[model samples]
Target chain A: MHPQLQLLVALQDMTGMIKEVEEKGSELEGMGFKTAGLDDLKRAREELEGQIEPQLMGAFQRLTAKFGRAVVPVVGNHCTGCFAQIPSSFVSKTNAGKLQRCESCGRILYWP
Target chain B: MDIAEVLKNTSPELFLPDLKATDKESALSELVAGLTAGMDIKNPDTILQMLQSRESLGSTAVGPGIAFPHGRTLAVQRLTILMARSTAGVDFDSEDGEPTHLFFVLIAPPQDLGHQYIKSLATLIDTVQEASLREKLMAADDYEAFCAALRGE
Candidate 1:
């Protein structure tokens, strides 16, 4: 994977983690569980965001806000996020390590 | 290789019914605690963290009230599967926006060269995707019935 794509994948994973921790943090605190991981993940996300390209970062944030996941795997020519079948041309571009977005869902697509 | 065979190899002690947790984190902690008590796991906290990290990637809830929360960790010697059911349901952040009632927590070693881990995962996903089987599993009154449900009995 390209360094930028790798960074975006990391950022996406971190975003997911941050969301989960925030959503469940209060409930966990009520149960006496330490939520320090949430802070660490948030900081990590910020650091990752700094590494990604500005335009890509903006797109990522927008897609993540719209759909819980911004980067989705293309499995057998289908965008796993939206279950939409991607064109073979897009699949080839993704396989070539180009950062591409699904025409249907607008989520970043990668071949895993 | 089949899901029933996989469940058969897993300890009966891991199948839990009527789990009391009302939310995802508590439900996860409860399952990790069970693993700590029954298995050779040394650090429950670390294992819980790993599972939570995996959950952050996506809500494991595959749909129809079942969620598969899994992680690869160094704490286990082999692939370990723990099953739990919450009749009251828990907010697992499922894509369908419905409360989740069934959870299958799968823990695997960091290195699964034989590909047994993914195969088991695929089997679990295929098995649960069957609405009839899921219904039977959910309607089961006890562990034995649960096993029978998995066995397609």
Candidate 2:
């Protein structure tokens, strides 16, 4: 599948988790859970966000930025992406529209 | 092939072929439909249905003009991937208010290949983040041209 799009989805998930943690921290403050624990939680959230931001930004940059345009096409029983050996049978099947995977890389392949 | 070498071969033959769309679904449906068919999917309905089911769980539209819809299987054969470009673009309930022109669909088989799958996905993600590449693809007027531009030729 397109990797850039996948990364974006993953970033969204991380963002949601961060939001939940923030909410929990606020709730603890309201209920007087523990100052030290709440502080720790907030710190953890910041770290996570910092890490997530660069990755997500990079992913978005690639996707919207056009980094993966040259996705290879499988040709002559070889994976164009990984150049891995695809069985002759699998290659034929993929051509026949039955679906085939590269033995090495495992990405579903199609004839160019 | 070494991962680096394989990664370097960005020709249309590696991706952007074998996708057959019988009919156009909605914007999201188009993305799902294109990917399922592109992979020569085994159970197209299964993945399609799962994506539909996900809206009930929560929106797959993760914002930023991107959406991630995935499904599980007790006995999947292998992971399959599908990518598509909608020239006209579509609205996916994104936060950026930008029309989605690019899409990636992932189908994982029921095996312990999760780590490998993630690796392949990461590579794909890296590719998508290139700004110059995106411009070329957007300029493509047809599928053939699109494929060529994707290859950077």
Worst 10 residues of 2 chain B by lDDT: B1-10
> What's the residue-level lDDT of A73 in candidate 2?
40
For model 2, how many clashes?
27
> Considering only N, C-alpha and C atoms within 3 Å, which residue pairs clash in candidate 1?
none
Candidate 1, fnat value? Answer: 0.02
Question: Per-residue CA lDDT of candidate 2, range B1-153, in tens?
Answer: 223432332333324422233222464465555554444444344445444433433434442434444433321345554456655666654446576566555555423234344454445544545677777766666556755554556
- Worst 10-residue lDDT window for candidate 1 chain A reads A27-36
lDDT of each: 0.72, 0.45
lDDT tens digits, residue span A80-102, model 1: 77899998886465456677788
Supply fnat for every model shown. 0.02, 0.00
Residue-wise C-alpha lDDT for candidate 2, range A3-77, written one tens digit per residue: 332323333333333343355435423322122333444454355445544754554445323423222245555
